[model samples]
Every structure is written in structure tokens, then in C-alpha cells.
Target: MEKFTRLTSVAAPLAEADVDTDIIFPARFLLLLDKAGLGKHLFHERRHRRDGGMTDFVLNTPPFNEARILVADANFGSGSSREQAVWALADFGIRCVIAPSFGEIFFSNCFKNGVLPIVITGEAHANVMAAARTGQPFTVDLEAQTVLLPNGPALSFDIDPWRKRALLLGLDEIGGILADDAEDISAFEARHRVDNPWLFLDDGRMEQLLSQGDGK
Candidate 1:
């Protein structure tokens, strides 16, 4: 997962609420096991028509096609707990999603994959969506916890200090372990192996311990 310290790019405005995983990445696309080329399928139904035409979806707009930040309404990613929703967004180069609310499962999945799902006030969300209509670039500063608008004042948001630090430093779960207590971890493993000799099976003992630490 890439770090998301600070981002300044075109922001795609998806004002619709209750955007389920199916709408973000349809079930048909999930049949393919690869995460590649899914960006073209991100919002497949909304971007294409039944007659195999285009419907001018939010993501298909001019500069919005390259948007890194997404401004959306409440209950974003509400339906299923499919990890593909996060995959599609990240594959499409969307680093952050700003909304009034988000599905619990989807929110956790975002952090695990290094995506920042920012929760802002309803009024601020509306303001950002309205500004996105200009199709101009916006900035999301994770360190500052501010969303820079085009024609309006900067919008402030709250992210858990830990998650904010994680996103800013691009530290997913594994990264956190290495950063938070590398020495302590090494020392513990040494002590544990000395105290519990039976735990080590063979040459893969260290690898097994590292994997077990990651599972936490």
C-alpha cells in the first residue's frame, strides 16, 4: 500500500448517498480475480448504459477522470463488505474519500488498504461537492486534516490520531508493527524462543513468528 501523506489532484464529486459496493464495482467484474483494469469498471453501471453507451458519469467527467479525492454523500459504501470496493477505488487512483458517513466494514477496509475515508460535516460535504462541479483540482492534506476547496474556505475534518498518522505515513497494519515496536518485537521473540523451545518447529520458525505477529 502506498503512503497518503498529502494529495493535491482533481476531486470527483459523487453526491449520491447509499452507494453500495455493487454500484462501485458490479458483481460481473468481481469474477475476474485480478485487481488490474478494474478502474475502468469502477462504477460500471453508472458509467455505461444498457445499450452499451456512455452516460457521462461523475468519474467520466473531464479532469475528474484523474481525480484522487472523492467527495460523496452519506452512507457511502453501504451494502456489502466486499474488499473489491476498496480495490476498485485504489486501483482507480482514489486515495481519499470524503463523506458525511460510511459503512463500518467499508471504513475498516479502506484503512487496511491505505485509503483514507474522511468523515466531514454534512454542510462541508455539500460545499465540497458543489465546488467539484467546477472540475478543478483540490488538495487533501492528511497532516493538516484539511480539505482545500476551490472557491470556498478550507474544510476541517476529524480522523483518529492513529489513523491520521497511519495514512500520513502510509503505515498499514504491518507497517505499524515494524514502526511501533521493532526492537521490542525482536527482543520478545528471542526471549520466547529461549523460554519455549518447543515452539520452533524448523528453519521456518522466524518466518512463522513474523507471520503470527502480522495476524495480530
Candidate 2:
């Protein structure tokens, strides 16, 4: 996961609401086991026609193709609990997604995968959508929690302190737990071993178990 301190690049505007996981990365693409190469498949159905010709979608057009930020309407990332949606967005070089609201599962998955899903309303959302339409670049500063508009004004947004820290350090859930409490984990393991000595095998027994292949 890459640290998301600040991102300044062209934003693509998708003013449609309820842009679900299927629309973002169709279910057929989920057969892919690895996160690599999903970018090309991002918004696959919308970007391609039945004959494999490209459609006039925003992402298929110029300038927006290289967009690093996405400004979308409310209820962005709405159906299904697919983490691949985040993977596809990240692979496509979109570091941040600004919307009026997001599906709860999608919102949580974004942080885990290094995508910043920002919730903004009123003036902030309007300004970002306007900037994106003009193909102007905007900046999202996670540390400062501000979205800098092209013209002048900066819009502030809120993020949970721990999630913000995790993004800055590029730590996933397990990585964060280990980094923050390695000592505590070690201590707990030590105590567990002492309290449940029968769980541990002697050298002779361990070797026997290994030789048998199946521990039982």
C-alpha cells in the first residue's frame, strides 16, 4: 500500500449516483486472483461495447483517462461488498474519490487498499465537480484534510484520526495491529504457551508429527 499524503492531478467527473461495484469492475473480472492488471478492466462494461469498441464514457475520453482523482455524485460505490472495486480504482491511478456519500463497506475497503474515499457536501462537492469538468487538476491533502481547488479556495473534509494515520503510514489492518502492539502480542503468546503447555509438542513428538505429515 502506498502512503497517501497528498495527490494533485486531473479529476474525472462521474456525476451519476449509485455507481456500484459491478459498474466499477464487472463481476466477470473477479475471476482474476491478483490485483495487478485490473486497471484496464475498470468500468469495463461502461467503457466497452458488445463489439469491443470503446464507448464515449468519461474515463474513455482524453484528459480523464489519466485522472488521479474521481468526483462522483452521492451514494457512490453502492452495491456488493467487493474489495476489487477499490483495487481497480487504485490500479487505475485514482488515489482519491470524492462523493457526497459512499457505501459503508466500500468506504472501509478504500482505506485498507490505499484509496481515499472522501465525503464532502454542499459547496465542496460542487466545486470539485466543476473543476473536474474543466479538466483542471485538484489536490487532496490527507494530512491537512483539505481539497485544494484550482481557482483558489480550499475545502476542508473530515476523516477519522486512526484511518488518517493508517493511510499516511501505508499500514493495513493487520500491519497496523502488529506495528502498534508487537510487544503486547509477544507477551500474550508467552503467557498462552505457559498456561497451555500441553498444546506444545516435545522435540521427539514434533518430529514424529512432521514425519506423519498429518498432525493428528
Candidate 3:
């Protein structure tokens, strides 16, 4: 996972609410084994017509095509618990998603993949959406927990402290758990070795087994 600190980039606005995971990455691309190369498939169903021709979607346009921040309406990422949704966004170079609300599962997936899902409501949400429409650049400061608009006052947002720390340190859930309890893990391993000697292979025993195999 990459460390997410302060990101300043062009933001694309998708004002529709209830934008689901299927719309973001589609079900067809879900068969992919790896997260890489999914960027081109981001918003596939919406960005392309039935005939496979490109549509006039915001992401398919200039300026917005290079957007790294996405400003969306309420209930963003609402549908199935597909982790690929976050993978598609991250692969597309989108580091942050600003919405009034997000689906619980999708919201959690964002942090796991280094995508910052920000909940900004009321004036701040309106302001950021407005800025995105003009293709203006905005900044998201994970350290400060604020979204800096191009012309308006910075909007503050809240995130779990542990999630923030994990993003800052580029630690995924597994990485965070291991890192947080490294000493305990080491101590447990030491105790386990003493308690269950049969669980480990003794060097002398291994050498004896190898000698027996050679003799056979």
C-alpha cells in the first residue's frame, strides 16, 4: 500500500447518488486476477455504449480524464461488497473519493487499498462538487483531515485514527496488525517453541534424518 499524505489534483464530479460498485468497475472485469490494468475498465458500463463505443461521460473527457480526485454525491459506492471497486479506482490513479456518504463495505475497502474515502457534507460537499465541475484542482490532506477547495474555505472531515495511521504509514490491515503486535508475536513464538518442541524440527534431528536418507 502507498502512503497517502497530501494529494492535490484535478477532481471529477459525479453528482448522481447511489453510484454502485457495478457502475464503477462492472461485473465483466471482475474475472481479472490482478488489480493492475483495471483502470481502463473503470466505469466501463457507463463510459462505453453497448456497441463498445465511448460515451460522453465525464471521465472520458479531457481534463477530467486525468483526474485523481473524485467528488460524488450521497450514497456513493453503494451496492455489492466487491473489493475490485477500490482496486479499479486506485489503478485509475484516483487517490481520494469525496462523498456525503458511502456504503459500509466499500468505505472500508478504500482504506485497505490506500484509497481515501472522505465524508464531506453540507456546504463543504456542495463546494467541492462545484469546484470539481470547473475542473479545478483540490487538495486532500490526510494529516489535517481537511479538503482544501480552490476558492472556498477548507472543509474538515473525520476518519478513524487507526485508519488514518494505517494510510499514513502505508500499512494494510495485515501489515498493521503484525506491526502493532510484533513484540507480542515474537514472545508468543518463543513460548510456543518451548511448549511444543515437537512442532519445530531440531537441527540435530534434521541432520540425522538426512544421514539416514543418504544411507538408504
Q: Which 10-residue window of candidate 2 scores lowest in summed lDDT? A: 207-216
For 54-173, candidate 1 gives per-residue lDDT tens digits of 889878877888888898889999888888999999999998998899999999989988889999875777788888777788888888889888777888888888777777777888
- Candidate 1 lDDT (Cα, 0 to 1): 0.86
Q: TM-scores of all models?
A: 0.86, 0.90, 0.94
- Arranged by TM-score with the best first, the candidates are 3, 2, 1
lDDT per residue for candidate 2 within 106-212, as digits (tens), equals: 99999999999999998778878998999988889998999999896889999999899999999998888888899999999999999998788799987887888
lDDT of each: 0.86, 0.92, 0.93
- How does candidate 2 fare on TM-score? 0.90
Clashes of 2: 0
Residues 94-150, model 3: lDDT tens digits: 999999999999999999999999998998788889999998888999999999888
Rank by lDDT, descending?
3, 2, 1
**Cα RMSD (Å) between model 2 and the true structure?**
3.5
Q: Which candidate is the best by TM-score?
A: 3
lDDT-superior candidate, 2 or 3: 3
- How far out, in Å, is residue 67 in model 1? 1.2
